[model samples]
Target: MTAPRSGSILTTYRRHKELLLLLLPSMVLLVLFNYVPMVGLVLAFKDYMASLGMVRSPWVGLENFQRLFASEDFPRALRNTATISLLRLTFGFVAPIVLALMLNEVRVSWFKRGVQTLTYLPYFLSWVILGGMFLMLLGSEGPVNWLVQAAGHSPVSFLSNGAWFIVTIILTGIWQSAGYGAVIYLAALAGIDPNLYEAAAIDGAGRWKQTRHVTLPCLAPTIVVLLILSLSNILNAGFDQIYNMFNPMVYDVGDIIDTYVLRRMVYQDFGLATAAGLFKSVIGLLLVVSANGAARRLSGGEHGIW
Candidate 1:
């Protein structure tokens, strides 16, 4: 039996040699970029000295983590991460789903394609560029402020003001990502059987009824899967966007875990920064597991990471 299985495996490998060869580069890249860097995670528990190198670094156990949690900036960063993540999850998550549904209903192919192109164009632009564009647009003497002054009101600093800054981040995130994110839902929608809609129509269902009973039910599994996956990003509040858009003035409401770690690294606290990163990773893993479990239970084993 073992000899037969080995021969079978060899046969399969030989048959798919070309495909395996094609995948070799990606496999190598995955190991080099993703798996290899995991070794540096140990720096979180060590008093890392660049001169001593990773292997010779003194092991300090949880001291780095303790210092990270005890830092004055920790609470503010945590609060900002949680608030912004939640806001994005609430609004940003739904925007794509709605856009996908709307696009799916469009009868004109050219118009729908044009709409998709325009909406998703922002997603392809780097936040570094978009950040500067947004800043200029929202600047005190920029077009928006100029229009505000024309209307006889004070020029509000959208990027500098804490509350407005948070709202801006969420709205801009939705605008940037909604169209691209909707692509997944659109794929899911395409996989849905047209016969289901026909059946519903034959049963006296109108457009709204068909949508409620057919379209949504078919999309539920995909929605749940994406929602469970999103839980893992609870601590990640888009470093590029926040880092570029925010100044010290809005740190109270805009500083997130990534930005905090970047700040620590800038100050040469490598150990503390590593500890904070590890902390975020650990929390994110726990959240993914918990959310997966909840999704499995709520969905009667129909949805989960597993």
Candidate 2:
């Protein structure tokens, strides 16, 4: 039985040799860049030393994890990461879906395209550029503050205030990615069967009723899959955006695990940094698996990443 199974596998591969060849580079790259580096995860369990190297470094068992939990910054970073990610999941996640729905209702082609183009343009811009642009635009003496002062208000320290900084992060994050997300939802919307909408309309349903009954039901699987993916990244609080936008004033509210790990790396605390990373990976894996299981159970084994 094993010999027959092995032969069948080879036969299938031979039949799809061209397609597999096309996929070879990506598979190789994934192994090299992703799987290969996983070997370094062992550093999390060791007291890494420059002189002794990764293999020869003394084993520390759970000491690195213990120190990570004991650190003042780690707790703060963990809280901030969860807070920001949840905010993004709630508001930022919904924004794109809303935008896609609105766009789908637009009758004018040029106007809809223009809106999409303008909205998604920011996603292409690097955070370094956007961060600098935002810093200038939101500064005390900038145009935004100018308008605030003109309206009989004091200049708001958007970047310097912790609460305001969090608001800024959420708003800017939404602005940057909403268009791209909307495009994804729009593609999913296109795949929905037109007959479902027509059937609902034939039942004397209004546009809202049709959307609620037909459109939303059809979009459920896509929504479920995207929601599961979002939940899996509950620990990721947009490191690039936060790193570029954050300062000491907002550190209490904005600092996250990625940035915390970066600081550890800068200080050459390899074991602790690796431990933090391993912890995040473990949490993410558990979240994704749990989310997938819940989705399958709720959807009667029809929906989810699997």
Candidate 3:
């Protein structure tokens, strides 16, 4: 019996050998890039030194975590992260869905394609390039300020001012990511059955009614899944965007956990920075689990990461 079972396992493995071969590189990369680096997370608990190296670094237990929480900047960074993330979750999350729905409703293929192309172009542009463009556009001597001056108004200091800085980050973030986000929703929309729409129409339902009854219900699971995923990254306030676009003036509001960690690293407080990063990761993990659970309960177990 044991020999036959072993033989059956071997046969099954042989049957799917080609499929496993196809996945080998990706599996290797995942292990190398993702899993291997996870070992470095221990740096958070250690007093790291370049001379001593990771192995020789003395473990300080929770002292690094204590210092991280005690730092004045830490609270500010945490607040800013939560604020920016929540704002993005509320506003930025909806833009793509709305755009996707509007695009889905468009009957003109050429026009819809053109609009999609235009929207998607920005997502492909690195924040490094986009930041420079935005800086130029938002500068006092830039076209935007020039227009404001022309209108007999003062030129607003967009990047310098705290309130405006947050607004600018959120808006730019939406612009950069919304199109890419919409692609997922568009795919989901495409997967909806045409028969449902036809049935709704047969029942004398208008476009809005059909959309409300059929489209939205079908989209609910996708929306829930995406929302849960987004919740997991609530601490990540686009490091590339903020690092490139932010100035010292707006650091009070614009500095997120990532930038805070970068700043700590600049000061050579490796353990503190690592602790902050680890804290962020822990929070992210907790948020993911909680959000997944809530989504499952809310969706009657129909939608969740699990």
Candidate 4:
């Protein structure tokens, strides 16, 4: 029986050999880059010393985590991360859904295509470029301020002010990401059966009613999945964007877990940095599992990433 099962497995693999070959590199890369790095998570539990190496490092248990919690900066960074993430989830998440809906309603092909192109262009550009551009444009003597002065108002300190910096981060995050997110919804929209729309119209449903009833219902699964993914990354809070755009003045509002970990690594506090990273990963995993369970329950097991 065992020999027969092994032979069947070999026959199945031979039948799908081409597809398996194509998947080989991706499997190798995933193991090398993702799984291999997971071994270093043990650094979070050790008093790591360069001379002693990872295996030889002295175990410190939860000392790093205790230090992490005791640090004055950790709480502030946690608060800021949660605040920014919620804001992004609220506004940034909705922006793409709205854009996709609007684009779906557009009659003119060229106009719809043009709008998509313009919106998606920013997503392709790095934060390094966008950050510099924003800094220059929002500077005291910059064009935005020049326009404000022209309107008989003072120049606003967008980057320097904490509240204003949070606003800037949210708005810029929406601008950079909304288009790409819209593309996802657009693909989902494209998969919806046209017959549903036609049936709705036949039943005396207007465009708005059709959208509210048919389109939205069809989109529910996609929305739920994306929401789960977004919630799981609640601690992320756009590290690259904040790191490039932030400064000393806005640290109170803009500093996040990733940035805090980065500073720790920079100062050669490897154990603490690893602990912070491990904490974040653990939280993210928990969130994903919780969100998935909740989604399944809410949707009667019809929706979720399972």
Candidate 5:
């Protein structure tokens, strides 16, 4: 009995040997790039002078966190980050699903492919280039403002204004990411059985009704998974986009946790900067856990991110 059991185990391991070999590099990279750096989180709670170094430095429990929360700019930055993130969650989350539905309805494969290519191109462009494009279109004398002022109303400042920059960030966030997000729904659409749609149509269901009753219900699980994953990053708030487009005039409405850390890093306050980084990471961890727990409790679905 023991010999047969050992033989079965060896046979199973041999069957998967090739697949395991292929995955070995990625597992190694994950450990080296991701899990290994977690030790540096200690810097968040320590006063690291060059003389004392990381390990030898005296531990200062929560002093950095205390200073961080006490700062006036931190609250304003938190609000700006939250508002932009919520707006992105609303529009950006749904925009791709809508795009996918429209794409799926396209009878012509070529047209669908063309639409996919056009939308996906923007996702690859760097934020620096996108920033330049927005600047040209929304600048003080740019064509968009040019047209606006060409009409009766006075010219509005796009960059320097706080409120408008918030809108600009949200719109740009959608533009850069929506198409890529659509690719997931497109794959989900491909999984759906065409027989379901045919049956609905035979039952006299119209296009909108087919979408509402058939497509949406089939897509509900995918939507739930994506929503749970998105909730994990509710605190991110697109640091690169905001950093490139914003200036001192709009920091109150545009600054986020990442930008705050970057500013302190510039001043060479490594301790405070590390604390802020750790804070962002910890909040991200809590949000994901809470979101995943709620999802599991409500749906009894399996989406353990860990």
Candidate 6:
């Protein structure tokens, strides 16, 4: 029995050899870029002396983490990061679903394709360029401010105010990412059986009924997967966007874990920066795991993210 099972495994592996060969380069890059750098996570627990080097660095237990816990900026930064993340998660989770549903309803092929192109275009723009454009449009003296003045309101300094910083981050995230993320939902929507819609319509169900019953139910699996993935990324508040858009005046509301680490690194506190990074990574791992577990329970033996 064991011999036959082993032979069967070998046969399946051999049959998929070409596919595995195709995946080799990506796996190699993943190991090199993603896995290999994990070794540096140990720096979090060490006193990284400039002259001592990494290997020669003295182990400092949890001193780095202790300092981080006691830092003046830690509490406020954590709150801001969590608030921004939650906002993005709420909006980000719904935008793609709505876009996918709307796209599916568009019967005109050309119009649908044009909308897709327009939506996806922003995803390709560099953060620096997009940030500058957004700043110009939302600046104190920009076109938006002009409109606000015309609307009988005072001009708002979007980039300078801590109160508006988090809102700006969430809005920019939606602008930048909603389209690219919608592609997966669009594909999922496509795979849904149109015959189900036809059947529902034949049975006297209107468009709303069809969408509520057939469309949403069919798309539930994809939605669950996407939600899990999004939740797992609670810590990842888009470093590139936040880093490029943030100013000193907005740091109280805009500084996230990633930006904080980068700041510490630039200031030459390698050990503390590494500790903060490690803290974020550990929380991120727990979140993903918990999300996967919740998915399994909710889906009840259907395909899970794990």
- Candidates in order have lDDT scores of 0.91, 0.92, 0.92, 0.92, 0.87, 0.87
Query: Across residues 1-306, which tens digit of lDDT does each residue of candidate 5 receive?
Result: 344454576787798899889999999999999987788789889987879888998999999889888988777777878888888999889999999999999999999999999888889999899988998888878888878888966778888898888888888888888889899899989999999999999999999999999999988988987788788888899988888899999887888988988998898787888998998899998998988887776567665464
Could you tell me which 10 consecutive residues in candidate 4 have the lowest summed lDDT?
Answer: 1-10
Segments in model 1 whose C-alpha atoms lie over 4 Å from true places: 1-36, 289-306
lDDT, candidate 1, 189-291, per-residue tens: 9999999999999999998898899999999888877887796778988999999899999999998999999999998889999989888988988988888
Stronger candidate by TM-score (1 vs 3): 3
Q: Which ten-residue region of model 6 has the weakest summed lDDT?
A: 1-10
| TM-scores, one per candidate | 0.85, 0.88, 0.87, 0.87, 0.86, 0.87
Q: Flag regions of model 3 displaced more than 4 Å.
A: 1-33, 293-306
Those runs of model 6 whose alpha carbons end farther than 4 Å from true positions after fitting are 1-36, 300-306
Model 1 lDDT, full chain set: 0.91
Which segments of model 2 are wrong by more than 4 Å?
1-31, 296-303
Task: Judging by TM-score against the true structure, name the best candidate.
Answer: 2
lDDT of 2 by residue, 1-306 (tens): 344454577898998899999999999999999997799899999999999999999999999999999999998999999999999999998999999999998999999999999999999999999999999999999999999999999999999999999998999999999999999889988998888888888899999997788778878787877888788889999999999999988889998999999999999999999999999999989998998888888778877778
lDDT of 4 by residue, 59-145 (tens): 999999999999988888899999999999999999999999999999999999999999999999999999999999999989989
Question: Which residue pairs does candidate 3 place in steric collision?
Answer: none
**Per-residue alpha-carbon lDDT of model 3 for 1-306, expressed as tens digits?**
344454576797898899989999999999999987788889999999989998799999999988888888998999999999999999999999999999999999999999999998999899999999999999999999999999999999989999999998999999998989999999999999999999999999999999999999999889988888788888988899999999899989988999999999999988899899989989888988988888888888977878
- Model 2 steric clash total: 0
TM-score of 2: 0.88
Shift in Å, residue 4, candidate 4: 2.1
What CA root-mean-square deviation does each model show from the true structure?
Answer: 3.7, 3.4, 3.4, 3.4, 4.1, 4.1
lDDT of 6 at 92: 74
In candidate 2, residue 247 scores what lDDT? 91
